[model samples]
Target: MLYNRASLTNEELIKLYKQMLLPRLIEEKMLILLRQGKISKWFSGIGQEAISVGVTSALTHDEYILPMHRNLGVFTTREIPLYRLFSQWQGKANGFTKGRDRSFHFGTQEYKIVGMISHLGPQLGIADGIALANKLRKDKKACAVFTGDGGTSEGDFHEALNVASVWNLPVLFCVENNGYGLSTPTSEQYNCEHIADRGIGYGMESHIIDGNNILEVYTKVSELAESIRENPRPILLEFKTFRMRGHEEASGTKYVPDQLMEEWAVKDPIDNYRNFLIEEKILTPEEDEKFKDEFKNTIQEHLNATFEEAPITSSIENELNDVYKISSPTTIAPNSTTQNIRLIDAISEGLRQSMERYDDLVVMGQDVAEYGGVFKITEGFIEAFGKDRVRNTPICESAIVSLAYGLVVNGMKAVMEMQFADFVSTGFNPIVNLLAKSHYRWNQEADVVIRMPCGAGVGAGPFHSQTNEAWFTKTPGLKVIYPAFPYDAKGLLTAAINDLNPVLFFEHKGLYRSTYQEVPTDYYTLPLGKASLLKEGNEVTIISFGAAVHWALETLEQVSVSADLIDLRSLQPLDTETIYNSVKKTGKVIILQEDSLFGSVSSDISSLIMENCFEYLDAPVKRVASIETPIPFAGNLEKEYLPKNRFKEELLQLIAY
Candidate 1:
């Protein structure tokens, strides 16, 4: 099949030819560097440069773009330094990643280019989020995200498409179909011939174009981008191209046929566009040669200047720099005043007070506004704060978290809720990449609180029942908190809201309705990174958190042994002073948790005790936790699987030691 060359302008045809030539030359030089071992690895968008440059040139610079790893042409056309790009490929600090991020993760905030998160389809959800923020701010900016045909198979892709359509977000999903995902062909991956067919299921408009034709790519992308900006709807585009080389430097095209390679080489986009330019009389042979020489010299000068300068180096001290904006220590004093309040009431009141104090705070999630959330944690918030401040989002976990990250980045304090802790994994990419590492990567504080209901005791079963604190405790730049009673819940949440970093507020499903010590009616806050001593004893120290604290307290009363009960409020910053002091007083220690034993918080606590308080201990630290298996659906098995009588038995053994 052939396309007519009479429709396009001569200058536009010549420009497309020049763009393709530069990227091809740049990739050839990179392949040479890779072969010589000057660069460790490289991924080239060799045969698919037309789609990248054409689409990027069509969009406005003020708009946001989330390009994938194979988008060097887009970045180059956007005026990202070629030298910096090469330096990044060589793992130098002079690259945009500051010597920390990989080559594909390049981005500059000044260019309105949101960084490319390496995760496959998760960036699609985040692109919708950026568009959502722009809409909320009344800014006329659209978001464009690039992904491969192989990525459409991921659940996140479908999830993001659904949400973008539902919310009418100004986002464009570009699918660059380069024929293969590494060695696997598209025929083996999906039954559908084109990825654009899947977009129909989500009620989105889609297009399929010849990816090798720069004129076609540019014309289609320009129209779709403008249409999305005007109507604020999502668009899905499928660009059909071929992979001329291996997927990456490590992969070889041994399985590919020589005939197929020769066939694609004959239809090279750059050569085709060059012929179109000559047919249109855009340039003579002498003029074309001059243009090629000028571009090569300009690129060489940029590369020379970039490589000659000193590169940024990584250091151990830099790791400690961006966790939080550490200001001069401000003294905080706890109020002695007290009043009675219920657990649920305390949570609602704390949110009210925080919202009243900070105008930047915005709360959103599934059923958070109109229905007041599933657990009623956000009850009466919409009526009190108005719709702009309190929003109800569709049941899209990944989109909800990604939108929260966008809001926080734009100087808004965001509080998002996961319907249940088990669903948090759906949004794990943005939570780990954007929220957890925002400050660490760009020295930007992300004030976001993710409220999730966790723990199993009310028969939520395997799907609904899960304790995920252990999953994020090991992650840097995240503060995990679990409160036992109403007072701590209110105070700790308030403190977390005030923090300039991301915090995971895990509320126990069992403790939400359980009666506990009352909280004060007046506004107050509790300092984070501190533990409460429920009971003081000398025999053994029993440390626990959240609903497990209640079990530990009950076991201490039943047994004749007097034990020290310490409630750990903050999982990330463990109260070392309080824990060590209790361990010193009692030579024996028992760590109790409701989660599985493998890689749980109990393991970290036990290791900490052995490392810091080993000399003061008489017996080895014992851990009492749920069995290392999935929570069963049956009542009897679930009861047996949970750490019930085990805590008492472990405490007794430690005390008797």
Candidate 2:
């Protein structure tokens, strides 16, 4: 007999019972494998099967979900092959991330599941993006993200909640209040009565439930999911439960009190739910035992097959595959006819044209909508694209970037902006880890353009004036584009937007309205990793990017010596062919950058010249860059700190040598 209130057929109840049992039994088998030196590691979700199974069963397959390591039931309920799960834990190549990332630290598109990163909170921000996508497309899909009681403490949690509430997007924040974050107790983790209280702070509806009761969890989540789909609002659900096992297999339960464990042991979700089924006459004890045996036997078969499969065999060549889907090498030349526009206007034109071209392209940032951004780069964007496409986000840099990654995960392209380049420190994790590494880890495309307004010249001081390109250039799986002229700015912005990977497009703040060049207005993409030869001569090679390229141009006019002046439009993929050829002919080179000398992009150029062009060198390679001290507010001191005054001196010395 099926429960009358639930309207669940006997088969659905039986299936839920089986789904919960499989993860528990599989974890038991995995624990044995871990001890026998077969699998490397495991995180046992022995007591938390119901939460995963119940919540996942409540939502439809189309609704996206982000889960954690303890969500083994989620994978099982979604009907992912048991072999893949076992193979994944064993780091096999057939695993979701091809053994690149272990456990639930990977997203599988087939299952519509995006697993969490080690840093718990960012997933919530990604949830916001997925929810926003659903809202814009009118898909009636409520996005859900899982977190522990401890994960609610992350700033991303607050940021995501606020945005979801403000925009009335369809999202469900599911917190399995397992009473501990690692070894930290709930008493120590927060001062609130429940994680659900955070919902009140965000003006979102909140609920608490007995997580050990599978029927209650299923009923509540089903109702909430339906409501979110209908009304398109965010909700927070805090399921109060206990961690009957240690956080992971290696961490023992000693940190948990003996009394607490004894209390929760009797309330084990699977055991209680089985007893309830027996009371309803829906299942018999003999049948429950039979079900366990059947699941165990099936799990064993998959485990045997998985273990027979060879573990991941890796080498440098294998590991290096798919780090990035780099921007294709474009051979098409721009239109011969052009109009003069400022560097910032060129950026605006490129963005406008791309928006006109791709309907799904989204532009999001702070003060970017009605206010036109701090520098007015996004002026009149709302009027052109409307609010859905042109979104003005909260001042949360970290979540904003992760949100863009979330959109990319759901088959949409995002162009996010940082108000100031120096502020990128807050959002570095998503850029370097999620966006940059997604393709390499799980083949998830994070096709995002993060526009960074960088460089020094105006007396914006340390917070606003910074050339932080070196940080991203050193990171693999990222394209760093820094264009010095308005033409390259418009052309490369088009290219960065077209790239299938994450791109950090650096716009020198000083050059936004300061310089102008004739640029094509139509949609066109210049080749990435290609540098422009502004002036070609043989006495010296003066290579620079961003604002310093202009200074190099001016310094060339001061000197009588003929030099090869090259502007690096893209930083990560260096135009080495152009640099090497020029270095061989010029024999002497002086690298210029607005960033500090040590550990800068210029440092890499200097080394490359010495290594590849050493035999042809006429003098030692010199570097002109900012002083070691922080940028000062005084105009004169700022000029002294930068390469504006130093590039000419370095070029003259190289020429004299």
Candidate 3:
């Protein structure tokens, strides 16, 4: 009752047989490599080869595929060289990730494939964004993202599916229900009758098929893919299959019953398909045996050469190379015009100008459409750019951040705004793990600017009020920008959008209306890693950023102390030249930060000054920062907790010392 072999031509039937046979041979050779001590680990798809081969063969090569670690057949079907696969498994320097990552954790832009992280479900949202980009470009291409039955339990799966369904994006969410998630069975994971049925709640077209039936899988998924390309919509496909071996070679078969293994052994997809091919007269018995022998020999050759190749040699110094791309400062004309603007207006104007300059720029966040965001920063953007460009996403922080990688990798720049900086915790994995390490691993550009509305004084409480720049300062490959003045906010943000790296732009909610400055009317940019010298003095150098800069400036005015004030616009790439020069002039240094005192950016700066300018110090570096507790809800408690007055006290004490 499945797809009939009589419905296909002899050539099509032969191609299907070869596709299924190749991954099976590849997995077998991989196991041999594991025993020979060439590969450290192997996550094989022995029983699930039909699903990978069928699904990949259904789609065109131009359409993108975001595959999991077990889906090596997708790479093989894409015609990736056998040498690269063997090299990657052998940990040779010629692998796709240059031996930086093992197994299937490598992809190239030329192939339109983005490899998976250890966390599986985030790629669903990334595929959603790629589909969105295709829609923007009016391309009739769809993307397919794969995951296992256990991955459905992740929150990213639900968020991505919901968004794809809502926007009618061309994404195919495939769940290879292999009966078990590691050691746990399906009954323990979900209560649903079938994983495919869950798609109905999201209003997506759903299908469930026998995964071992290659003809059925190829026919159904190919039709569904064509439908998705013609009219953009998500399709949830669940393939019911089982893993023949244990989770890994090291895992014994004690967990799987002998009776279950026997049942699947009789129904082996390769054996059944070969018999079908003979019955249908597609190939003679001798021809089929010769075909398989040829593939086995080819795989053996690649495996043999892979062992002869040199193992990847790397050092700690190699890791320090590609954290950030070297980008020059933006050039501004000498006669550029200026206009007075508020801090928030300057930020909004910068977003507008960047969008005008780049055709592929998208501005997205929660309540950012007609509602103009919670802070009204994007009030009129929807009218100007339309709903497609100015998107209003749901309150799913992880998906919002995950989509940025998908957009940027597909020839687009994204400006993502978090409703509040405190909510960034929900999306921390992709931000720190994936986006930050993208360029370092594969030399891909993550051109994204994540706008974070941070800080206290608005009585928004802990959930809404937070300055989380410290959390990202330790992460490599991310540029952190926290501007105090309106001019710097506009200039820095503009430069961040244009730069070829991931940037976290922190804008304080308190400074949105309080700060005012004459910003440029047209376009201009300030260089990153360059600190602004606000007030020059010879006694002590006070280094700060964001709202803390204003507090330090106010304290300096009231104390009448001759102290050098430095506002660090960019935190990650610290302005060592400016800080060292100022330390030479003023022998004393005081670091003031508004965040919690423990593990603060101020602590990092203080340590840097101590290590680099130890001789220039007249006294040990002093740090004045917030108390080590949550920002309080009450107005009086919040004021006492922040204690901006402490800056003046700390400054006066340091001067006396």
Please give the RMSD to the true structure for each candidate, in Å.
3.2, 1.8, 1.5
**Ten residues in sequence with the least summed lDDT for candidate 3:** 326-335
Candidate 3 deviant stretches above 4 angstroms: 1-3, 314-318, 326-335
| Residue 460 displacement (Å), model 3 | 1.4
**Model-by-model lDDT, in order?**
0.81, 0.87, 0.87
Q: What is the per-residue lDDT of model 3 for residues 267-297, given as tens digits with 9 covering 90 to 100? A: 7888888888888677799998898899998
TM-score each candidate. Answer: 0.90, 0.97, 0.98
Candidate 1's C-alpha runs over 4 A off are 1-18, 309-312, 320-339, 352-362, 385-396, 409-413, 433-447, 498-500, 516-525, 557-564, 632-639
Predicted candidate 1 versus true structure: per-residue lDDT over 594-652, tens digit per residue: 89999999999999999999999999999999998998878888899899767777777
Error of 2 at 317 (Å): 3.7
Which ranges of candidate 2 are over 4 A from the true structure?
Answer: 1-5, 326-333
Q: Give the distance in Å from residue 263's predicted Cα in candidate 3 to where it truly belongs.
A: 1.7
